[model samples]
Target: MTRAPAPGHGGMASTRTHSAEKKRNSVTKAPTRLWGGRFEGGPSDALARLSVSVQFDWRLAPYDLMGSRAHARVLNRAGLLTDDELERMIGALDDLEAACRSGEFRPAVADEDVHTALERGLLERLGALGGKLRAGRSRNDQVATDLRLYLRDHARQIVSRLVELETALIAQAEHNLGVAAPGMTHLQHAQPVLFSHQLLAHVQPLTRDIDRLRDWDKRAAISPLGSGALAGSSLPLDPQATAAELGFDAAAPNSMDAVADRDFVAEFLFAAALIGVHLSRLGEEVCLWASQEFRWIEMDDTYATGSSIMPQKKNPDVAELARGKAGRLIGHLVGLLTTLKGLPLTYNRDLQEDKEGAFDAVETLLLVLPAMSGLIATMRVNTERLETSAPDGFALATDLAELLVRRGVAFRDAHEVVGHLVVWCQVNDKDFDDLTDDELAKVSPHLTPDVREVLNVQGALASRKAYGGTAPDRVREQIAALRAQVNDHASWAADSEA
Candidate 1:
């Protein structure tokens, strides 16, 4: 074999030489495979087609390059490369990163995955010296490291977007404070509540979702970079150093677990799925409220869609999509869990199945969150309609029962009394407000004229003044508390990006 040129003398000159050679032999020269030095021949065409991952995983190139930079530092500390070689290697990686970002460099047809493609880029720049960077690490650990970094970065982004949605909710609540609406149990009006309280209910789940992402980051912060192919490297590599350089809390403690563990991905999928479920519920409400039967809201023209055929239609498409995509997100979570269930310890080819679901889920949420936020921020609430219909379905019957309880009637007796009054009103075609004192006296002895005190929607709303209740003051307190939470989450997300 012809001897390759040495490193220092041909650094930049080698790049130009390799670039020209790459063009001249673009079709004819066989791409280098990361493994199979001992094999007599290349993989079969079918095997190559089935094994390829460069398409979806190429998005991981930035994180992969980040790992490579930190790995280079560890290799230099291990004395695997001279200081000058490390410097040259870091420079080459930076150049390659710029190329990747600008789309000048990309995976070719034969490149199996991101690692192979990036390695090719490095080799093109530094010639044989580029091959030295792979020492003391395997694709197993490298990929695990890349994924953790990718998720950590995205978790912060998701939190930031979540806060934006929360902020929209807070604004709507503040604007509509003290507006009373029918609160339901089992979709039947049970009581009257501040409309702000209903809007704030959606914020609670999103806050927990943000908390879950923050909590998930704690477990995901440990790096797996130095675990070489499910076994520790024989070389004197410093994994803790690599972990710190890459912003991981520490190195993974077990070699086999480092390469094999995908619990982080599963947990992320769960968080994402739960977010979808919560949004689905919110979407269901939007659909109902915008319907002619409810007429509780009117969606903005920008957010609502016009029907192709029906001139009168202004469809809640954003809310419908939110409800529809929830199932897709749920399927991604279940699919990943099923994929992970029977996986044996250490890395397997099945682990390759992890990235696409995660990538798609993240992309889905990133797309959905901003749209949902805009939908909420821009839509108009029909406060008059909500307030007028607040007590239409005997919504204050419970308040009437409780009012009798305060007047020394046993709750059971009061409940029976209110039941009779509701039946009497339905039969007589008269609401409680329309009942005369003589009519009230005939229904029950406890149905004195003063019973009308609890019959109106505003009185029913004001009666529930306990903490976390639907009273106006309580709902204001709840809104303040949520605003504080949104601020704290916003700060945490900002710090994480920093």
Candidate 2:
């Protein structure tokens, strides 16, 4: 009998034959199942489609590998693996990690989830020895630990981006320190405020967001690695050693709680959603400022997009997307909360619904924060327009009222006098600067010429000397304090990354 030619041995004929043989092997191979010893047959195609999560959870591959390494060490300490076996296992895992990072190893079509795909890779590398690593842990505890590691790493990234945005706001405030703008109450000018004051207002909410993330980290640092299935393993595995190896503060106190708790994910979603809301508010202002009607800011050509139909248009699409994505971020939070609301779990299939939304939320904020920071940093402020419009719509009327109060006039009476004076000025088509001595006396005897001192925009802005006020001096102090806070937050984020 003649033996078949070896693959790639004969020119084109051998290459074609090799391709056919590889295709046949792929078609005939069955997926490795992690569990199913009790089942008589495979799951239906419909069940398989619904159950597979390797598409999204595959992003957790790195974290999953880290968990496996830690588990291998713990198993070695328990004498489940010999010293030679442990070293071999570590070498194989390191090779697998390189393949994963280089995109050479990936999930096969039948892989159920990240864990199953990674296990298959391990088996391919080490054969029967790979099975030993799964001795003390279940997918239940494994997935829980992987997600915490994933979120903990990404949370630092989110904080660093937040600090970048805050630093941009601080830079804008410092650059426009002396500029004045009309501050609005009901979208109508209410007072003359230093432009720096408005920019710094956004920084305050972001500081709180950073604090929330830092606080959330404290609760998310516990490991769940040895919490097998639900009730923990009966083996001699050391969970504390695994937790320390994985960078967790401690192993979970209770195995059931360890696998079932998704509160960390929910809390993270809340923090992300609130950051979205704050960005939405800032984006709304950017949209208004960039419009022709406001013209308080001019969008930089690099950051702003042009309309395809309107050549003259420099649209604030960056800010508009920031506004639009806030809704998407909020929906992710609510969707995850709804998924988690009814599950009575030690570990239920419903819990698998958690990863996609949390992953998307983190990715969305990471995208939005940097774009917004560049927009704020590069946009040009129209200081002349801001100062010119600062005292429009009788914005200084409150200053006049307060002046009368300081002269021993009752506040109620002073308010009444200022109200009438505004009416007279409106009907006569004149502002406070246009008012004659005879006209002031007729409007209100208390409208003495001394009131003129506070009627102008400069005087209106300067008179607010109280701490936290919009006075230029107060704004300078606020900027200094905020800079120190941003520096501290930057240091915290750096430590987290380290």
Candidate 3:
């Protein structure tokens, strides 16, 4: 791939303006060549199109301008720029930002990337003073710094969306207290579990995703501004000053690694991929539960969609989209990692591939999260159907086995007894409740009238009151714990911005 012109070389116009009138006219003059005294002529049309990244990267204009402001301050501190020059440069940058925000400033066909476009804008505003701002900076370190700041801000936004989805889960769990459903393993009914317990299972992984974002932020906080074009800058620059001004924890220790490292990007994509997987799991369940065969829940009209031809059809489009989008999220992660896998120990054109994937992953999640939270919040569980089906498919067979174990039978013997009872019920088309005491005795010598006590679904549910169990009490306790954790994370996210 064709690489755009790197920064911090001999690009800007020479600072030799003797006449004040000529300098004033320079501000409105056509932009000077970004690469001066090098090539004989312009690049090929194909090369320019292939190298331009300002179209997609224009979103980084604000962040690039922010880093430039910090860089200007550092340059002034190092006495490389006079106070008046620094003041004019900052004022021009402020004007550029306002124009960018108002859509009045944008990349032209000649602007190769965000850095170049912003440079052109600054020159248009302040002439030679704008040229001075490029002294101690390079697009290599500038792009790196801008990306970190952008990801830091957007990661917090993604976390807040996750918290909203988590809060919706906890609320649903609390509201569905005491409701029972058939828990499945391998897509077959296994046991009776409180509906709340299943909801909390989804919340557990998302809480870890939130923690991953926090951990990723810590590593991404180091600034790379002074690592000019893969080596330390020649100027008497204060990297720490710029780091502090940009809200970074510190400067990166190595110039080569500082410009080349993309671990933070990969880590963020991994977090997003996992979240997509989690949401896909929820989507699959919602799709199953909302179907005619299950009828365990109903999607609200706001989230569900009608078939184009079939007027009676109400499809769970949001859940299906969530499930489908998971593959896209995984694709983004894999593509980015593949791009980073073979690069050398410095900045390269291939690194430009990183931003689009990460951007897609972030944008995908930001859109999916609120839709998911709304889907869960507006969904109505069919409590009567859930409660009625909780005991079907021999779901209480485990309870029968445990009851026999309590009556002094060995566990192996109890398991055998329940296995035989299940086979009998399956062949005869009769449930466990259909059997009388004599019929039960005929199946096992350990049978007794009190065995009926554990045969009911509620008895089976209450019997497992162990911590983290699906019992109503245990599920309620889990709901409370999750709520506290979510609230704590929300507070931490707020303080991160502060």
Ranking by TM-score: 1, 2, 3
lDDT of 1 by residue, 261-282 (tens): 9999999999999999988999
lDDT of each: 0.88, 0.88, 0.85
Off by over 4 Å in 1: 1-28
The TM-scores, one per candidate, come to 0.95, 0.94, 0.93
Candidate 2: residue pairs that collide: none
What's the CA error at residue 114 for candidate 2, in Å?
Answer: 0.5
lDDT of 3 by residue, 291-408 (tens): 9999999999999999889999999999999999999999998999899888888999999998988878888999999999999999999999999999989999988888878878
The Cα RMSD in angstroms, rounded to one decimal, for candidate 1 relative to the true structure is 6.2
Candidate 2 lDDT over 155-258, as tens digits, reads 88899999999999999999998999999988889988988999999999999999999899889999999999999999999999999888889999999999
Better of 2 and 3 by TM-score: 2
